[model samples]
Target: MSDTSGSQTNITDGQQVQLLERVSVAVVTTLPCCVFLFINVTMLFTLRSKPVFCETSRYVLLYNLLFADTVQMALGHLLYLFAACRLFLTYPVCGLLILLACFTTTIAPLTLLVMSLERYVAVCYPLRHTTIITIRNTGVAIVVIWAFSSLNILTRVLLLLEFPFKDLESLQMKEFCSGVYVLLGPRSKDYDRAFICVLFVSAGVAISFSYFGVIIAARSASTDKASARKALNTLLLHLVQLCLILSSTMFDPLFMALSGILTRIVFVRLYRVLYIFISLFPRCLCSLIYGIRDQTIRPVLMQHLCCGFLKPAVSNSK
Candidate 1:
């Protein structure tokens, strides 16, 4: 009797520990997510609040990129919360959420590619930058990016249709909803891997070309030394951001690989760490990089972020 009682106590203690861990993980992730979401939302508002932001081509691209990242971050967090809470969604429902997340995920790198090229044009062809990087052209690029991403989503939907959904006892998922779990077959996985590889590789090449093109242009005596230097710095930042985004994509596979080796407790701890840094942090980088670094954006973004507190100070100074 004593032994049985002790075993029950042990099991109860273990369950309590797990509950504590889950709550801690949720708090840690949720707090940062809420903070970043606020900043991104503020930055988005700041972008649209001013005529300069709306009229400029790069700002238009930044708006589109930030919009995509904001959506991706929100959806990603929602999905993470659902999984943490052990909320099992229907296949159709889960697929929709994952597809939306995936859709936005593709936009970041592609927009970065365009942004890099825009910088390249600004440096290499200063005379024609206005002609080449017009607001109309920027809008068309945004449209093309969305259309390309939609086509990818459409292909995934078709692949999902091939799944034997009717054979299942119900539409309700048997496990936590994730991109890997939602993939109904090997073919889906293969196509996904292939698509991601192609997309990132192509974007990387284009961005790298732009980076080098800027470097070569910087060497020319004709180029504005200050402008070329700034573009080079921006290109370098873009490269780092791209690498971070690429690392975030590896989280799923990394977790899957580590799961088989690590005990559940260890795996859970590792997962929280990886998800925080790898998945969540990258989504917030755009706001941090652009909001703080850009001279034009910094003051306005700070004003919005501080809820107009800075406005009085600026007026007083002026």
Candidate 2:
């Protein structure tokens, strides 16, 4: 309801619709971003103190994915916070950020796909793991995925920058969303349907298939039945989580393809709301997965969270 920069916002005084929606998004965005931010920053600093002995591509991919999600959740959500605080700058802000978010959003699934492939290599070709897979190589590949994703986003941003957005009430910062990234004018509106379809489909398919291959390869490994079972169960949980995250992205295109106006409105609103909440998951869940599920990683987290505190206590008592 408060437009700080005087640039015009979506909701007017009498219209109570978007005001409530914006408030809801702000709450969800703020709470989760704070929690995930703490977890991610804590993990980054503790990585050096306790190292995981293995040096596989998947290991490196895991850390890099964390790094990427931290950026997306912490810094990216901060962008929304700024837009909320300074609503008047919505026009140019919308212009600059929407395009950049395209890249950030795109790279997430791509990184997941890379992780899946690395897992596949580690399991399927265990003998060739050292020869074929390296952390440095995975890091380079991550850079490549980021570069490729950025290429598309930069192009989208360039296309969007040329358009003249008059700033419609529903398009700018209203209730359901904080950032001006979704602002759609006559020219810019082309982005919603076909464009999102391409980006989401490609990334989702890549991620899904990569994991599918990993699951298959893991099952085929010669590890003991008990170890294989544990690995499969863990991988299944990861798959379900990844699916939830990827499926949420498809909502945009799905909404666009719908024929009914009411359905479209409801879906788009849901899309924006889900977007704010879902983006936080990978950051926190990645930490939990690496820390809780894997015998290899849980100790590292425990050492950092527990040993760091307990060591000095025992020493002082002695």
Whole-model Cα lDDT of every candidate shown, in order: 0.88, 0.58
List the pairs of residues colliding in candidate 2: 7-88, 18-175, 21-175, 21-176, 22-175, 22-176
> Candidate 1: where are CA atoms >4 Å away?
1-20, 312-318
Could you tell me every candidate's TM-score relative to the true structure?
0.92, 0.67
> Counting only residues 3 or more apart in sequence or on different chains, how many pairs clash (N, Cα, C under 3 Å) in candidate 2?
6
lDDT of 2 by residue, 204-226 (tens): 56655655655666565474445
Please, what are the lDDT tens digits per residue for candidate 1 over residues 4-83? Answer: 99999999999998789778778888999999899899999999997888999989999998999899889988888887
Q: Which structure among the candidates has the greatest TM-score?
A: 1
What is the Cα-based TM-score of model 1?
0.92
